[model samples]
Target: MDRQFEAGPRVAAVICAAGAGSRAGRAEPKQFREIGGEAMLTSAVRLFLDHPRVGHLNVVIGAGQRARYDAAVAGFSDPRLGAPSIGGATRQASVRAGLAALDAEAPDIVLVHDAARPFASTGLIDRAIEAALRDGGAVPAAPVTDTICVAAADGSRGETFDRAALRALQTPQAFRYADLVAAHARAEAEGRDDFTDDGALYAWAGGRVALFEGEARNIKLTTQDQFDDDLLRRAGRAFLAQGDVRTGSGFDVHAFGPGDHVMLGGVRVPHAFGLMGHSDADVALHALTDAVLGALGDGDIGAHFPPSDAAWKGADSAQFLADACRRVREAGGAVAHLDLTVIGESPKVGPHREAIRARIAEIAGVAIGRVGVKATTTESLGFAGRREGLAALASATIRLPFRDEDGL
Candidate 1:
């Protein structure tokens, strides 16, 4: 409809998340890897999802990563979130792909952002928008804090560049949508895809560019160390700020049945017999799920995924745990800790304790250290001691907001 800067301009965000993250040394792309309980790319895309100014959201990802990308963002749904677009060989190509995807609506303003920079605040987005409105294109930039040098090939001392005049470019680089698309198209035609970012491409195409204040903490996740600490996100500064602490306990049991393997704690463990239930019967996960739901004042597993329903027949128990975690988030809470105990006489849990913990963390979307797994026997006292069945007990500690109606 050609809504170019119309009354209440339509804003679109192009998130470039195609990088393989070779520097981070991870097998999966850094964008899809979990960072602070969520994928880095998802964390970045969510900021614009519910924004009033952002009418459309497009994300570019690497080829053959659709399933991986979908899994990372499966928990988030918003009207502004658009379908995924496959990226090209380079970052510039990826941004252009996202912009092309955004052409259907013809938004007035476009913000080209990196999915690696999850910390880009809403205030920064506003600043970029303001600058782009004033200038033809705008990029958020911070003053070069470190002295840079143009060194020679053999480590010889060379000309030193003045740090005061240099600026470190950041993303969510805002621009007139039409102009930015044209610039990218021109670069592609001219075989000038060498530019590292859209700002450089715009400048190379003789477009006027303005620099706005950039956040010092909004660092892109390139190296492993940066993703390791993640202090800002791990600390839960954005949410989980209240003092309403709560706890809950859960227990689940399933008798041994006919199968070669059993699903326990989201991990496939080998055994002569499997657990019998409507679902895959991940006893550990079921107990943990109930623990989380109980902590949130929600119903237990049977109430949610009932055995009467055929849909839950052989259904993966991971989904149950995922749903419980989502409810915690919906209730304005986060899981602080999870303690699980596995009771059985055979098929030792010690051999797979770490793997079980890792799977639980992945399913709960929490850190591995936050999950504790232990195994014990009832000393020949009950069904577990008789090797008739296995049991799991779980405890969950969570933090939620204080509501006066709840009366603590």
Candidate 2:
């Protein structure tokens, strides 16, 4: 029985990645292959998981692929992502398995997508969901540019198709959940599993599938040549040009106070006395955060988080660094590297260098290799050398899209 489409239906997505992808000439499945330094499956799943309209999500993986699937989605956790479903022999069976897995959620609408097509934008997903809610079923398609012809057994053209009337289909095909479930069930009952895509399967079951515009960049990675570096650059997954690189430096100092330990780079180190400041006095993190802001051409840390505010009293300075990194990302940039030098006569940073580096990397969402932590002594010449306080100097290197006004 077909259920009627309603307003604001609960939308779910099924990422089908069970095929062997032998045509792509890869040892592993193409979906598990890397694109822009990330698994194609990961790229595809991230899109749907990030979309506000997508409610529940699931990925259908081939058998004996649990390890690969785990590796692909490592560090990715969201309430919307459900358990991975093991797929069957054929693509049709795999999608059926995925749909069956989602049956427990009982979504009102479902989008069946190919994991190899990672460039499906949020706007495309929105169009799919909207068309499904309004038309019961829909597929995103672009008009065919090349003239197509039906060839005979000997490869001679038997019929020619008007290019204007032809369309190249792309996933994710959307459908009313119950209606699609029923359609797949009918096909299974009739021993028909040859349908190329969900849209074709639904149409075979007498479901009228609608069409919406699809992006030219929303292409499927079916051939080995499609995995070119140019494609990654087009997807914004590649590193920016060197001309966009920028560097900024920052320095901070704090006086000795009456406390047992001090926070430095999000790590607590035992000391004779803590540094005095409105916050926890993590001078290392403060300098690094300021350095990031400086690279972004933003104001210093004090301007963003004033010490005059009581709300920041004893606040963890890691939050400050995290917020600064967030701003860099929001400004369409990435933190390339961070270097910090701590100067003090006591509470030696040598023992905590690795720990501090890891913590800073975690806060900045970069690799530990990108973070450098070191210690230096003032030889008892300055306040830091006299054990009166601690000081930190930081340098941050960032990459951003270059602006024409910079006159590179």
- Which candidate ranks first by TM-score, i.e. highest? 2
lDDT of 2 by residue, 321-385 (tens): 99999998887778989999999888989888866876787688765657899999999988988
State the lDDT at 256 in candidate 2.
Answer: 93
Residue 395, model 1, lDDT: 99
Off by over 4 Å in 1: 1-6, 229-408
What are the candidates' C-alpha RMSDs? 18.5, 13.0
Highest lDDT model number: 2
lDDT of each: 0.85, 0.88
Model 2 TM-score, all chains together: 0.60
Give lDDT: candidate 1, residue 263.
87
